[model samples]
Target: MSVKTKLRAPSTVLVLLALCLLVSVFAISGGEYQMTPWQVLKVLFGQGEGIENMVIWQWRMPRAVAALLFGAALALSGAVFQSLTRNPLGSPDIIGFSTGAYTGALITLTVLGGGFVATSLGALTGGLLTALLVYLLAWRNGTAGFRLILVGIGISSVLASFNHFLVLRAELDVAMAAAVWGAGTLNGLTWQSVTPVGILVVLVSALLLANSSQLRMLQLGDDLCRALGMRVERTKLLLVVLAVFLVAAVTSLAGPIAFVALVAPQIARRLAGSAGLQLVPTALVGALLLASSDLLAQRLFAPVQLPVGVVTVCFGGLYLIYLLNRRTTKV
Candidate 1:
C-alpha cells in the first residue's frame, strides 16, 4: 500500500509539474507584446536578439517567476498551518496574517513613506506579532483547534477594522497607494523583486520539509504526540513561526495576495484525495493556481489588468462556500 501510494503521488506530481511548465511557457509567451515559445526559450537562455529577447527576458519571465514563488510560498504556509491546527479552514488570510501584513505595510507606506525595506520589515513585524498574539489568546490548558480558530477569526476582524480605519484616515495619495497594495498587484515585478522572494521560498520550504515528520505527529493531538516521543509544543511553535515567515515574506513582497494560501492546500488535498496535509503537491498546485490566475488577470480584462488577488478572491470565495456546504451535508 505504501509503495502504491508512493508510485501514484510521484506520477501525479510529475503531471502537475508538466502542467505548471506548459502553462508558465504560455504565460511567458503572452502579453501586449507576444513572443513565441522558441523566442522565450532563446531569450531565457541568452541566445535571442534585440527586442524579442528584451521583452521576454526583462518583463514576462520575471512576472512568471514571481507568480511561481508567491504561489508556492502561499501554499506551503497554508499547508503548515492546516497541519498544525488540524483545520482545513486554517489560512493566513483567515487567521489575520494578511491583515496584519497589510496594516504594517499601510502604516509604513502612509506614515514613513514608501521605503521598500522599511515596508517589508514592518510587514514582517506585524505578521509575527499578530500570530503571537493569536496563539497567546488561544492558549488554554490545551490549545484546541476550535479555540485557535475562534481566536484567529476574532483577531482578524479587529485587525481588518483597524486597517480600514487607518486607510480611511490617510492622505489621498497614501490611501490610494495603500488600497492598491491591499488589492495585491504583481505590476512592476522586475527580476530584482523576483530574486529575493524566490530565495525566501526555497529557504522556508526547506524548513517545512525538515519539520514534516513532526507535523504528522502533531495531527495525532498533543498528548498522543507526546506519547509518541514528539515534542508537540516545540513542533507547533516552529511550524507557526515558519508559516508566519513564509506568509509574511510573500505578503510584504506582494501585499497579502488573497486566496492563494487558502485555496491551494484544499485543491491539492482534493487532488491527492484523503488528507491530513501534503506539502510538495500543495506547493505545485499553488504554483499552477497563482500562475494561471495571473495569466487570467493579465489577459482576461486586457488593458485594465485586474490584480491577481481579485481573481483568486472571487474564485476562492466561491470554492470556500462550496466546501462549507459539503461540510454541512456531511455533518
Candidate 2:
C-alpha cells in the first residue's frame, strides 16, 4: 500500500469512530426527557439522581449500545458477503437471511405465542436454514457469486410471501405484534435483552478480524487464492458461516433492521478509497449510521417516535435506486 493510502485509511477510520461516539452521546442525551452532556456523564459515573440515572442507564444507554453493535455486525457481515460474492448487492437483507429470520419470528409469535427467548431461537433457526438452502442451491460445480445472489433473491421472495401469509392468518393482536417487531424498533430494549447479543457480536467480530487475511486472499479470485496456498472453499465456507451468525444474532435481537448491511461496506470502501473491503471502517460507519438514525427516529416527531427500521428503509430505498441507475449507466 502507498504511504499516503496508509495514512488516509487510519484517519478515515478514526473519524468514523469519533462520529460514532458523538452520535451515541447524542442518542443518550436527546431523548424525550432531555439531559445535557454533563448530566449524561454524571449518570454514566453513577452520580446522577434516580430518574436521570434510570433513564440513561436502563433505557437509552442499552438501546444506543444495541444499535451500535447491531449496525457493526450487519456492516461486517455485508462486507464479507460482498467480498465473497464479488457483487455490490450481496447482503444478508437482500439475499433472504433477514426475511427468513422474520419468518421465524412470525411463526413463534403467531403459532406458539412465544416469548422473547423462544422467538429469538426461532428467528435464528429460520435464518440459518435459509442460508443453508441458498448455499446448497447455489453450489453448482462450486459457488459463484452471481449465482448465489440470484438464488438468494429468489428464496428471499418466496420467504417474504410466506411471511405475509403468516401475518395475515394470525389473530389481530398477534399479527399486530409481529408486524411491529418486523419493523425493527429498538424501543424498550434493556441491558438484559441486549447483553447476549452484545457478547455474540463482540466474539464474532473478533473472529472475523482474525481471518481478515484469508478474506483478502479470497477476493483475489479462486485460482490466485489457491496458488497462494489458501483453502479457497474452506475459507469461503467459514466466512459465510460467520456472516450468517452475525446476521442471525442481530435479527433475533432487533428483528432484522435493514440496509446497514447493504450500504455500510460500500460507503466505507468509497470513503477509504480502497479496492478491497475495510472491515473496521465498515463497522464504524455502520455504528455511526444506525446510532444517528435511531436518534432521528426518536426525536423527529416528539411524542410519536418512528421505528429505526422505517428510517433506514427510506434511506436504503433511495440508495438502491442510485445503485441501479449507476449500474445501468455502466452497462
Please report the candidate that would top lDDT against the real structure.
2
- lDDT, each prediction: 0.84, 0.88
lDDT of 2 by residue, 269-324 (tens): 99998888799999998888888889899889966878899989988889999998
Question: Best TM-score goes to which candidate?
Answer: 2
Which lDDT value does model 1 have at 113?
82
In model 1, pairs of residues that clash are: none
Rate residue 147 of model 1 by lDDT.
Answer: 81
- Candidate 1: Cα lDDT at 74: 91
| Steric overlap count per candidate | 0, 0
lDDT of 1 by residue, 1-331 (tens): 5876667667778988998888888888887887788777777677888998778778877888888888988999988877777777888888888788777877887877868878888888889999899999999866677788889989989988988888898999888877887888887888887787678778988988888888877877788888987777777888898888888888887887877888898888878755666888899999999999988998898877888899889888998898899999999
